[model samples]
Target: MDLQAIRTFCRAVEAGNLTAAAKALHITKSVASRRCQSLEDGLGVKLLARNTKGVTPTDEGALFYERGIRILDDVEDAAQAVKHTSDNLVGTLRFTAPRSFADLKLGPPLMAFAQQHPGLKLEMNLTDERVDIIGGGFDLGLRIAPELSDTSLIARKICDIRHHVVASPAYLEAHGTPKTPEDLKDHNCVFYSNVEAAKQWRFGTGNNARAVRVTGQVTSNSGLMQLAAAVEGVAIATLPDFFLEDAVRDGKVIKLFEDVPRAPSYLYALYPERRLLPLKVRLFIDFMADWFAVPENHCEV
Candidate 1:
């Protein structure tokens, strides 16, 4: 089988037309069409259906495309594996991560990686929204969650993250401190709307666990905004330790209910599952693990 023809067919399926695929592959449309025709003839199956809407993969073609993607990925991974023995690393790494984490924790180490490999280019999309890593053409993603989502991607644990209920000293002074979890109900609580239970904050551990229904002066999807509100003495906020570390260290924010316990979440590095992983992606993952292993690199509660 011709890998080039298979690649061209897959590209055409992804691009939704031969013309688009040709432009992307830097080949003429006639060449792309010829490759697809040759692929279908060799396989004895009509891979694509052409019409006024351009071209679309047939049912069998769609299935073939999926396998083709993995085949191509495996081929590239094999090439990268051989290249791994060299001292120099070169490639573009496109990844996505949460905005707050990127700003506070990820930026430094990733920048150092970029500096170390001058031939490498990094493109990072920092947002809280869950991105379609494969569809979006991202090489890797960093996610912080209590439980991993069911997906085809491979995930490796980076570190454990704990949430802290905090408020400015002035806010606590004026509104009074919450001595217990229940006391939060009486205070103005800033909430991260993106959280699963934005209004319901849980405390303690198994068997003794309890949930508190909280109402606040403000609610937003951004954790940074919630942290800002808490810092300005506007409302109490439950934020990850990484975001509250500097604030607590400077006395800008005070952690509440030191005795109360909150469920701990984890930071994970996610990437597509492949038989032979790329050296660049593997190197980054290793670097992140090492970076987080150093206590000073992460926030301590």
Candidate 2:
């Protein structure tokens, strides 16, 4: 069987139309049609069914397409492995990360990486919403959590992230600082809607630890929004060290409950599990781990 024909068939399945597949492959529609027909004939099966809306693979075609994708991935991995020796990284690296991290921490290191490999293209989607990395065709993801829920993806801890309950000096002065976690109920708190834990702030650790359901005038999915509100004396916010480092240093915000031990969290680099990891993904993970280890970039608790 012709690999090109198999590729064309796979593209058709992805594109959902012969013309679109042909355009993507830079081939004529007739050529695309012939390739699909040839692939079907060689296998002695009907591969696709066409309709006014578009086209869909038959059951047999769907099974074949899955295998075809794996075959193509293997071929690309083999090529990338050989190309690694030349120190030339090409093609696109698509990834997703939290918007707050993307804005504060990812810009510098990722830009430096892109500059080093002029041939590489970086596509990043920064949002608070959790994305389906594999379904979205993302090469890798950066996440901050105490523990990852998806066991299918391989996660490597890049660095430890510390969380703190902080408020602007003015806000604390007006609302009065809480001597303990229980005192938080009397004060208005800024909640991050995206995080489940944000609804209930956890303080201390082990037997002494406690969870408090706090109320706030402002609730937002964006950490930056919560940080801004906290800075303006709106309310107290439980935020990560990376987001509040500059503010705390500048005296814009004051970290509260100095003796309280917050739960442990870490910055994680997550990617789909495979027998042979792609060189680009592996290199990126290593670079980020090293970058975060630098003292200047470290977020000390």
- Model 1 per-residue lDDT at 245: 73
Query: What residue runs in model 1 are displaced by over 4 Å at the alpha carbon?
Result: 1-42, 46-70, 81-86
Off by over 4 Å in 2: 1-70, 206-209
Q: Give the TM-score of candidate 2.
A: 0.78
Tens-digit lDDT track for model 1 on 176-251? Answer: 9888999988999988866688899888777888899999889898888988999999999989988887788899
lDDT of all predictions: 0.84, 0.84
TM-score of each candidate structure, all chains considered together:
0.81, 0.78
Cα error of candidate 1 at position 194, Å: 2.7
lDDT of 1 at 115: 79
